[model samples]
Every structure is written in structure tokens, then in C-alpha cells.
Target: MQNLENGFIIKQVDFKDNDKILTIFTKKGKLSVIAKGAKSGKRANLLDLANYIEFQTIKSKGLDIITTISMRNSFHLSKDKSSLYIFYPLEVISKIDRVDQDESQLFDLLNFTLSNLYKNQDLYISLFNIKTLLYEGLLSDFTNCFVCLKPLEVDIQNISSMMGISHFGCDLREYNVRGYPISIDTVKLLRYIKDLDLKAPHLGFDIKETVLKEILLFSTNLLESSFDIKLLSKNYIL
Candidate 1:
């Protein structure tokens, strides 16, 4: 039976001769399809990473064989920091396991993220990482201390590697992880970003370089640990 789906080509791997195996994240779900003779034919260019496409496939024993593909939108990346900004999120999304409850939201988030990266790389990257964690339900509560369960004081000194806020004198050894001493400003920035709507206008606040670094580090670590996947594109971001 033939099936038609609209989605982005998240990942691709070379197969025998001119064939390729593609991992597609569609509105419906994730699909692994083999494109027979796609490498040297008209279909080769259609399957490039981050290109949104509509494709036809035949499912056989839990695998799919691609029959035809039509490009819907092609995102061009420049040889600069902007390219790294765009590619990292794509790479991260490709590594995500499909969650039935969050697939549509994830798809929209990715589409929105890629669309906005060219306009404001830093804002979108930070927003994307924060939102991805929320969507995946990986973030711990931030309103109070994870251990004490009390409101966080201004002088609180540590952010747990488990993605929780903590106090200065908390027994870090109990958590079996080293904690980063985060400033109150960085914590506030994260909360502010997390509360903003995806379509909200660009953040008007001036984020310090130190705060930005902390956000990226915390989000990256949380995602890697939660998903059990390493992000190779992250190297480019740093």
C-alpha cells in the first residue's frame, strides 16, 4: 500500500550503491524510509537535511520504501555562524525520539525555530532549547529549592545538575552530582524566557554574556542527559 506524508528529512545515511536511508519526522510521526537510487537521481537534492518535503512511500514489515518526494521548503544555510545556529537544532531534533503526545508540538517548534534563526540566532537558539525541554518534560521545578522546597532566596548559590534550583549550603553530594553556582539574574532570565509565548516579539531585555552561557550549558546538559543522545552540532555553537 502507498502512503503520502508531509515532513522534514531529519537524517539521512548512504546505503548500497546509490540508495539512501532517511529518517523523516512528519506531522503523523517518525518514519524510517529507504530511498532506492536517490543519491544520483532527481530525488537526491530533494532529500537534503532541513528541507521540508512531501513524499510517497510503501510500508513493508515496519520499514518504508520511498517512491517519490517533492520539496516544499528548502532552507539555505550560509557558511557562517548562522549556519551553525540553524544546523544544531536540526541535529538535535533528529536525535529526539518520537513522543506520541508531543509530536505535533515538536514539529511546530522545529518549524518555528528554523524560520526565526536567520532573524535572531541567539534568541531563537535559547528559546528553542528551553521549549524543547518543556515539551519533553525534562525540566525540574524552578520556583523553589529542589531540596528544601522553600522559596528560593536571592543568595541561593547552586543549580543542580539534575536541572533543579538549590541553596548555597545544600549537600551536593547527596545528589551525586556537582552543581553550578548560578546567579539570580540567570535564573530570572530562564524563567522569563520559559514563560514567553512562542510568537511573542523579540525579548527586549539585555541578557549578559555570562547569563547566555549558563542558559546554553544548562539546557544542553539537561537535553543530553534526558535523551541519552549527544549533540554533535553543539560543538559549532560553542
Candidate 2:
């Protein structure tokens, strides 16, 4: 039987001669499918990374086999370094273990991000990072310290690269983790972004270069440290 799944191609690798293996992030979750003899054909183009595609696959004892596929959205964006930033979030999504109930939101986020990443690059990138933390139940409350459980009035000092928000002089090392010294403004920005609906317009998202860098850095740190995986797109984005 052939099952139809729509997803974004996150990674692709050469299998044997003329075959390609794709790791697609579908609404069901992450799936690996082999495209037999797809190395040089229309199927090859359809399997390109970051392309949104609907494909049919047959289950097997090993990897699923892609029987037929079609492109849904090519994104038509440049494959340059900066534009390839989607890989940062895609890589994270590909690695993390998300529940089935969360798949709908995750799939929608990737779809939206790919649609708007070209024009709203920074906003979507930051949104992806902050929202992923929220979906994964990792983002800490911005109003209080995750460590001391005390009310954090405007003096927040560090944001955990993986787990918590903290006040000044808190001992994050005691938890065997590291964090970046963050500003109240950045904290407010993150909290604000997190609360925004996925479909809401980000009309007021113009951010200072320094603060934007902080958000990116903290997000990168969070993904890397928490998952124990290095994001290939990290160097390009930062």
C-alpha cells in the first residue's frame, strides 16, 4: 500500500548508484524514505532539500520506499549561505523527538516559515527558535527566574542556552549548564514573540542588530546544547 505524506525535505544523501535517501519532516513526524534510481531525474529535483513536496511511499522492513512524488512549493529562494538559514530550524526539527499531537503545529510552522523566510528572514528565524522552545516545553517563564523561583523584576541577567531564564548572579553552572547574558529588552522581545499567534503579522519586528544577534546566539546555544547536535547552518546565520 502507498501512503501519501506532505512534508519539507530536510536532508538528502546519496544511497548506492542512482538512488537517494531523504529525511523528510512530515505532519506525522520525521520519516526516512529512499528514492530508488532518483539520482538524475525529475524525482531528483523534487527531492531537493527545503522543497515542500507530497510523496507516496510504501512501507518496508527497512526504510520506506518513495513510489511517486510531486512538488508542492519549491520556495524558489536562493541556495546561498544566508538564505539557507531554514536549515537551522529544519535541522533542529529533524533531530528533536516531538509528539504526534504537536506535529500539526510543527508542520504549519515550517510551511509558514518557508513561505515568508525570504522577506522576513530574521523575524521568522527568531520565531522558529523561540516557538520551538515553547512547543518542546523548554522555554522558561520570562517573568521569573527558573533557578531561584523568584520574581524577576527588570534585572534578568542570563538566559539559559537550553532551559531557563535567570536573574543576575544566579549559579547556572550548578545545574551543569551554560547561558548567555541577556538583556531585559531581548527577554521582552522573546516573550512577546512567543505569545504572538503563528498567523499574526509581525509589523513591529524591526530589531536592533546587537539584540538580534543575542536572540540568534541564545537560540543556537539552546538547540546545540540541549540536543547535543551541531547545527550546520549556525555558522552561516551568525
Candidate 3:
């Protein structure tokens, strides 16, 4: 039987002779496929990382075999300063287990985030992280204090590495947690992103360098703790 799917090439490894192994994140989920004679041909450059592709494959014993491929949307990130942001999400998605799970939402989020990276790299990266957490049901409520259940106003801090947020007077040692202080601006930014409509057009907002750095750090911590996967491409963004 032949299977048809549209996805992004998240990873690729050289195979013997003229073959290459690819990890594609499709609407269904992540799939590992072997593309024969793809190393040196018209298909060589077609199956590149971050390239959205529509392809046909045949299931074999271990991995699927790619029979044909057509390019969809190829994002040019070679010289883009936010190249690291592009790579980190791909690496994270590649590590996700391809079990019998629906990944359509993740696929959409990735596509949207990649498309908007050039517009605001830092914002998009933070958006991607926050969305990923929400999609995975790992994100905590940022609107109120986890301990007091009161509306969070100012001087918020990340209590737990995963998604715990608390006010300044909260006992950190009681929770047996420690994290950096998160400014109210960063908190508001995250809340704004969480409620944003990705498909709509809107004016961009300005963010301070300090706030951006704090948000990035908080996002990295959230991802690492929730997924237990280290993003090797993070160095590019840092």
C-alpha cells in the first residue's frame, strides 16, 4: 500500500551509497523514511531541513521508503539571524514519540511559527515554546497565583521549572523550587501570546532586551523540564 502525506523535513542522515534517511513531521505525526538515490540527484536538495514537502511512501519492515516527493513551501533560513530559533523547534519535534497520537495541532503551530520567524524571531520563539506547552497540556495558568489563587498583578517569578508561577512573597523553600525573577512585562507578554490569534494580522509590539532574555530563559526551562529533551541547536539562538 502507498501512503501520501505533507510534512516538513525535520532531520536527515546520510545513508549508504546514495541513500538518505529522513525524519519528517507530517500532519499525522513524525515518520522516518529512507529515500533511495536521493544523495546526488534532483531530489538531493529537495529533501532539506525546514522544507515543507508532499511525498508518497511505501511501508516496509522497519522504515518507510520514499517513492516520490514534491516541494511545498521551502523556507529560506540559511543566512537568517534567527536560524537557531528555526533549528531548535525542529530538533524538539524530531524527538517527539511517533506513537498513535494526533499531531495536527503541533504541525500547524510549527508551520505558523516558522513562517513568522523573520518578522520577530524572539517573539516567535517564545510563542512557539508557550504554544508547545499548551498543546502538550503542560502549561500552567499564568493569570493567577498557583498558591494563593489570587489574580497575579506584579513581581511574578517562576517557582517551578516546569510551569509553576508565584508571587514574590511565596515561600520558595516550601515548594522546594528555585528560579529566576520574571518581570511583569515578560509575564504580560506571555499572556498576550497565549491569547493571540496566529492567523490574524496585527501590529507588532516592542520588547526590552532584558525582558526578551528572561522570556527566552523561562521558555528554555519549561521545554527542558516538560519534554526532558535537550535542544542541541539552542546554542545558535543564545
Candidate 4:
């Protein structure tokens, strides 16, 4: 049946030159779509990742195909690193979010997150934490233990060799195999990211690079183990 759905583009890849596959986190489906002829201007450039818009689609028993897409005003203001990091969630989305499923809440969260991401690149990690929490259905604030739910106060002691950070009493390694520490900085960052109004610009922090690495590593471990996806981003980073 022909249908309409609203969504944000998660990932887009060229198919046969003009055809494109768009993994859209839609109000109804978190999976990707084969938007035939999208790259050739057959559709407005909703193929752009994070482009928020409505789509005309055809639903099959198996998969839904996007028939047409229209540009919405919300997508035009973003630029730079903000644009890139917003797509990073796909590293997680591609793994967990299912296609052809009703997921309007996920869609709204994605839209709001992207809006924030476009305005605040420095807060990308925090935003990433939010997406991760949404996927896991857990709270994103790192202030509490991923375990005991007790407020923590570590000064960065225990860390994973892969990205060990022993500050905030979180130590779940290898897809959260259970033995590692998360730094206070990670927790603090999460707390700040989840609650701070993006409308308010971040005042900046004094956390060291090592602490940042711990958060990244911890999140990476969780996401990779949970989703079985490789973040080639580490390989490509210059």
C-alpha cells in the first residue's frame, strides 16, 4: 500500500550511480530504505543524512520504499563537525533500530538531537551518550554507576587498557563484560550534556584529553559489543 512517513536520514549510499539507499530513522521504522533514483534529483535531497522531512512511501510485506521526499526547513542551518557527529549515531542505529517498525518516539529524539548537534559540536559526545541511552533504554547521565545507581566520585583511577579510565567507578569492558572503570569526567560530561539546555552555549571544561579518551573508549566498548558494528571512524581519524 502507498503510505507516508516522516523521518530523518541516517545514512545514504549510492546504488547503481543514481539510486540511493537511505537508512532513515522514521516515525514508523528505524531501518533503511532503497530510495530509487534519489541521487538523480528524482526526489528532493532528503538523501542527505539528518535531513528532517516527510516522505511518500510504498509499503511491501517485506520492506518499504521511499517514493518521494520533500525538504523541510529545519535542515538548512547546520554545518561542519556538528553535521558529521550527528551521523555517528548511525553506527549504533544501523545495528539496533529495526526497519518497518513503529518508532515515532525514536524519530522525535533523533530530530531533537540533530538540532542540538548542528548547534553544538563540542557537545557531540554528550549527545551520543543520549542516543546510546535511548537505544539501551537506560538513563544517559553518567553520574551514577552503570551498576549500583549510586552517585560516584572517582578521580580517574581504573581504566581499560583498550580505553581504561578509572575515575568514576565504571569498569565494564569488551562489550561490557564486567570489569573496568569509567572516569569522573565521563560521568560529569554526561550529566552536563543531558541536562544543559543546548540553547545555552557550553562554558567549556578543563577535563584532560585522557579523560575524554576514557569516555570515548567506554562508549565504544558498549556500542560495539551491543551492536556488533565496527566504528571505522577510529581508523579514518587524522
Candidate 5:
């Protein structure tokens, strides 16, 4: 059997006496595999499924079995309160994208975002990445107007409409083409975060206070209408 390497275990489940049903997100994409006898507290010593992990596996019969599990590195983020910060990305990724899909760039975006969420920096940077990258396209860098190719000025009143984002204009009248009007800073930071590591700088920007807020409102509306983002974040905070 061939071996699969260097993947993170996104999720896991127990079966029968001690088997595990695991959902893994690898660089090769996604998979659901069974690792035999992994449930008991004793056998549980085998793998730690928290943050990011490096792993290798072999296919046996119909399922992939873990050959080895690397060190556990996500302990800081997996704690109770920390996970609340990750809700937005997890919501967007699981909802809009199909399972077993290869979105290497998107996946890297998420990995970086996860690393940054706990850094006492702006969480909106993560949200911005989610917006222009996830729903928008490979060509959509959002730093400039798609039509005029000029830097955008955020007129917050016009920001609520999709026409503001997709077509790219300072005013709603500027576009005969219909599209969403994303925020100026939202576009800038979205482009910024895509390439930069998710190590959020000590930015003075506030998501709720900036035009970015309106952009997120628009992005949220679009995702909800197009995909079931709410359905994925069903695990709510208390």
C-alpha cells in the first residue's frame, strides 16, 4: 500500500469497540479514514488531534490507517475560549467549499489565520481574508477596482450592496455592471493577509469600527445567500 504524508487531522469519531473514524485534511486534499482500535484511553496515547499535526498513513482494505502521528502543536488554540475566535473561518471554509476538495491556497490562508487568532491582534484581518478570497476568485485581488483599476474609497452607505463590491466604483452610479461593493480597507487587508503570514500585526484597525465592518456584513450576507455558513458554526458559544 502507498503512504500518505504530512497532513493534519481535522476531526475524528469513535466506532465499534475502539476504532476511529477520522476526517483528515491533507495537502493532497481531504479524506475520511478508519484507524483501527484508537478509542480507548490506553490506545488514545497514539495520536493527539488538536492543532496542526504531521502524519503518515497507509491504505488497508478499504480505509487508510495511521502509520504514525507527529507532535501535537495546537494546544493553545484548542482550549475552550480560544476556539470562539476561530468560528468565522471554520464557518466559511466548511460551508462554501465542498469536501475532499483541493484548495491549497485557501488551506494555507486558514492555517495562517489560525496561528494569528490568539495573538492579541485584529481578528478582522482573518475575516477579511475569508471574504475576498473565499467567495471571490483567483483573479480577485480586491486591492483595486475591478473595472477602473483605481484604488477604492469606502463610501459606507453604498457599502451594503453587492453592486458596491463586484463592479468596483466609488459610487453606485459608477457601475452599470452589478456587483458587491466591498470596503476599501477590507480589500487592502484582504490582499495583505493572503500573502503575509497570519501573524497579525498590532494594528490600530478595528473591525467593528472600520469600513471593514460593513464589508464583513456584506460578505456575511453573500455567503449566507450562496452557501450555508450558519449551518457549519452550529457549535455556538455560551
Candidate 6:
């Protein structure tokens, strides 16, 4: 039997002379599909990464076979900067396993980010990274210290390379954890983002470039340290 679904083309690889292997992130989760005769034609365009697509697939023991596919939304990322925002999330999610268990939350988060990336690039970039960590259960609680287990006020905090977060003044000689210090402003912004509704209209806030860099760096380091995998797209942002 054939199944019909809509998904975003997160990753694609040329298979042979005329086919392509596509990694589509759907509401049901990520699917590996083989698009026969899709390497160079109308179908090839629709199969491009970052494009939202609707398609029918015949399930198999191996990768699903795409029988029919069409573009749903390309998101129109006009600027190079905007394109990286699309790439970062796609790259991160594609590498992490078991994200499909979140139901449609992961799919919706990407949809929301792509749909609204143009409105505020800096805001959406930070939100997308934070939301990814949130959905994956990787973010440390913003209201409390990760090491001390005490209520953390707004202040400079240290994010250890060993995957621990703590107040800057917290001792770490015994734990042997070392990390860079982040400002109180960075803490406030992260707490604010942790509380945001990604589906709702987020009024853009003023952010200094330095603070934005700090947020992105922290997120990248957290994911890398927790998963022990480097995020290549991070090089584009910071």
C-alpha cells in the first residue's frame, strides 16, 4: 500500500544516474525515500533540501520508494544568511536520532522557524537553536543551577565543556569542569527564549550582536558536548 504524507526535504543525496535518496522530515517523523528518475527534472527541483513537499511512498523493508512528489513550500530564503538558518536546523536534526518520538513538535518547530525566519533573523536563529535543544531534552534548566541544584538568579554563569552548567563563582576544582563565563544579559535572554511560544507571534526584541553570539555559542557547545558530535553549520553563524 502507498502512504501519503507531507514533509520537509532535510537532506538529499544523488543515488545513481537518474535517482536520488531523500531524507524527508514528516509529521510521522524522518523517512528515507528513493526518488527514481529524480536527478535531473521537475522532480529534482522539488526534491531539493529545505523544500517542504507532499508525496506518496510505497513502503519497503528498506528505504521507502517515492512514487509521486510535489513541492509544498520552498520558504524563499533569498539571502545567504537566511539560507544558513535553514541549513543549521536541518543539519542538527538529521544527525540526532529518535527526534520523531516528539510527535509533530519537531516538524512544527522547523516549519515555524522556516516560515518566520525572514521576520527577524537573529531572533529566529536563537529561538530555533533553543527550541531544538528543548525538544531534544538537552537544555539545562534556566531557573536553577545545573551543578549546585539551587535557584539561580540572573548572573554570569559558566557552561562547562563536560556538559555541566553552573554559577560563575561556583567551585569546580574537584569536578575538574572548565567552561567560559556568560554574562547576566545572556542569562536573561536565554531564560526569555526558554519561555517563548514558538508558534505564537514573537515581537522582536533588541539584541546586541555580542549577546547573540554568546547565545549561539552556548547552544552549539551544549549540543556538541552532550551528543559528542560537532555541529558543522555552527561555523557559519559564529
lDDT of each: 0.76, 0.75, 0.79, 0.57, 0.53, 0.75
Best by TM-score: 3
Worst 10 residues of 1 by lDDT: 154-163
Q: All candidates: CA RMSD in angstroms? A: 2.5, 2.6, 2.4, 5.1, 5.4, 2.5
Cα deviation at 184, candidate 2, in Å, is 1.7
Error of 5 at 52 (Å): 1.9
- Candidate 2 has what TM-score? 0.88
Candidate 1 lDDT over 49-138, as tens digits, reads 888998898876756898878998987667776776767877888888765653887788888888777765766687788888887777
Model 5, which residues run further than 4 Å from truth?
42-50, 78-80, 87-102, 120-125, 128-157, 162-217, 227-230, 234-238
lDDT of residue 49 for candidate 3: 89
Mark the regions of model 2 whose C-alpha exceeds 4 Å error after superposition.
Answer: 99-102, 154-163, 172-179
Model 1 bad stretches (over 4 Å) = 1-3, 60-62, 154-162, 171-173
Candidate numbers sorted by TM-score from highest down: 3, 6, 2, 1, 4, 5
Pairs clashing within candidate 6: none
User: Best candidate per lDDT, number?
Assistant: 3
1-238, model 2: which lDDT tens digit per residue? 6767788998888999998889998777888889898888666777778889888888888898999888989775675766767677778787776655648888888888778888767667887877777777777767788777777775545444335567645645456545657877777777788798877756464678777877777766765766677777777687
Give the TM-score (vs. native) of candidate 3: 0.89
TM values, all candidates:
0.86, 0.88, 0.89, 0.65, 0.63, 0.88
Candidate 4 lDDT by residue in tens digits, 147-208:
44444454335433222222223444223554555555666665665565545646365766
Flag the better candidate by lDDT, 3 or 4: 3
